[model samples]
Target: LPQTIVDTVVTTWRLEIRFLWIGSQCIIQDDNHDKVIEISCMPQIYGNACLTILASRSSSVTEGFLHERVISNDILCAKLAVKVFDQTAKIAHLIPQRKNVELEPLYRRAWALQERLLSSRKLSFGSLQTRWFCREMDDNTSLKDDSRDGWTFRERKGWEELERFELLGHWIKIDSQTADELSTQWYFLIDTYTSCEMTFEGDRLPAISAIAQRLAPRLGDYHAGLWGRNLLSQLMWTRVNKSKLAKDATPSWTWATAVGHCRYTDNDLTIPAATMLAMLAMTAATAFPTKISGAASAVTLGMSVTATAQAMETVTPCFILATLRCWFTLLKY
Candidate 1:
């Protein structure tokens, strides 16, 4: 590198940002494919990871702001990630500390929830000592004593507890936050989940299919990423960085369509679900029934490519009208 060129780049443009760079994009671009089509390839578990000591900058990147590690690599973690219910807590206290606890780095990383849920057994390295959790353990972590709930693990009831957990637990991450705020749940889920590195951007939907499937029966229809119920409110996603866009990753209408990070950062600017519902109620109150356009009635699959409906928030007639008008309006422009 010449001194003159280096100085010019530094002065003209701000940062020569560098990090882990995989050449899949470069390989594809040399041939110039219009779209990076997602292929269907399912693995045994949700996904598999490779643990290797590659001589890479990411392997050595341990300083300042970018020091956080995702829980995907050493990704297997059992339940008891968050505060367990009181019933589980009381029983775990009665159980003895028969197993060893591994307290190293369990409480960090958002993806730990996925690893924790997927793995059959988990040895958590927490703040204090290492805690053990397995399919057969009565109690795992000393959560009662150490701010983590151990009751669910006690009584050797970990597996049945896990079945219920597998179906019910994942919702907690979304519920815990959205139940309180009620507006930005989908944005939170996307901001945390999509930021993760994947083998292909196409693998995004397949990786999270289980969660989507589980929620379908409960949340009605599922759109590409947003829920049908909360479609309009959730669709207000703005890219954090305009330069990086995932234009072909998804349809032009979805947040997933954009490449960079985005969010419904300003909910105040958006109309409330309650207001939308109220308008629907008012329209229905009139002599003429407000006809919900057929396209607006669904936010599911096989619809028009322009169809961008999905479910998320509370169910209501206004939801259809609100998001339908929004979709048509967006398509029009």
Candidate 2:
């Protein structure tokens, strides 16, 4: 190769490399099957590890944001009690800039919701301060010292209620492993997950697929957005958008058909205590059946209403034909 040609090729290569993002958080995704898989895998990965959002991750942030993040990272009080034999120059004790620093821009993105929830431990640098959250904590607050700088830490009111509820459930040994229990848990998770926004409409299913994968083994089977084993019960979902019809992206029966939040708040997970006896009696013999038919996985009524009337060809054959035509026409949407 000519020397000039080699130099030009090297320069072009460097520019091409510059075009490709090599940042720590860059995600390479496109409109393909692999993109779906990548989106679906995110929840599982986050669920297994910690969700750490730091100031360093915010490349687009200004110097002011960085200064605030640095201030928040400073610990005014020691995390653990210590006995110091030698006293060196002590670190300056600066008060917290704010309780919650502005959350990084990444946190505002819709895709960050699952990552925040599923992570085992999450470290966030807000505009006001930095905080650490874990599944073990009753609340997400990492700092609980009001005694240090006369900073009184008033606990969130909701935390007390949640703690009491969890304690009660623990005492009774709620069936956390049973199918019924799984259903209740999934209901709560889906309600929260769907409430979060998504940038791409196409990512609707793939984004939540990891949570589905985790529950698939215990949840029987997944059909569209509903469960196959509990098909009858799953039909309880309603269309949120009444004025406009649901999009064809997903089946109308599934909740994913509408872009809205969903909640199943009968106020209790278990059947009412008054009807507990009825729940116990719901054995296979009493279970309602469903029929699976057709190549397109259509479901039909387990027990069909069959009616037959011999056409009175001699009396009113034309009338009978017209009546049948009118009935069929009414069925069209």
Candidates in order: C-alpha RMSD to true structure: 16.8, 15.5
Q: Write the per-residue lDDT of candidate 2 for residues 175-269, one digit (tens) a residue.
A: 35676666655565556556556656545555566555556667766655555555545544553343232343454555665566664443323
Clash counts for all predictions = 29, 9
Q: Identify the leading candidate in terms of lDDT.
A: 2
- Residue-by-residue lDDT tens digits, candidate 1, 1-333: 333233323422443333212222323543323222211111113233221111111211132112233433332334454556543322223332222111212212222334444444443333222345444343333434433344343343442343333223344333343322322334555665565444345444544444454444455455566566656555666777672655343545556665555665532233333223211111121322122111111133333332334343653333223212232223121
Q: Which 10 consecutive positions of candidate 2 have the poorest summed lDDT?
A: 322-331
How high is the CA lDDT of each candidate model?
Answer: 0.37, 0.42
**How much is the lDDT of residue 309 in candidate 2?**
38
TM-score for candidate 2: 0.49
lDDT of 1 at 82: 55
Query: Each model's TM-score, in the order given?
Result: 0.39, 0.49
Among the numbered candidates, top TM-score falls to 2
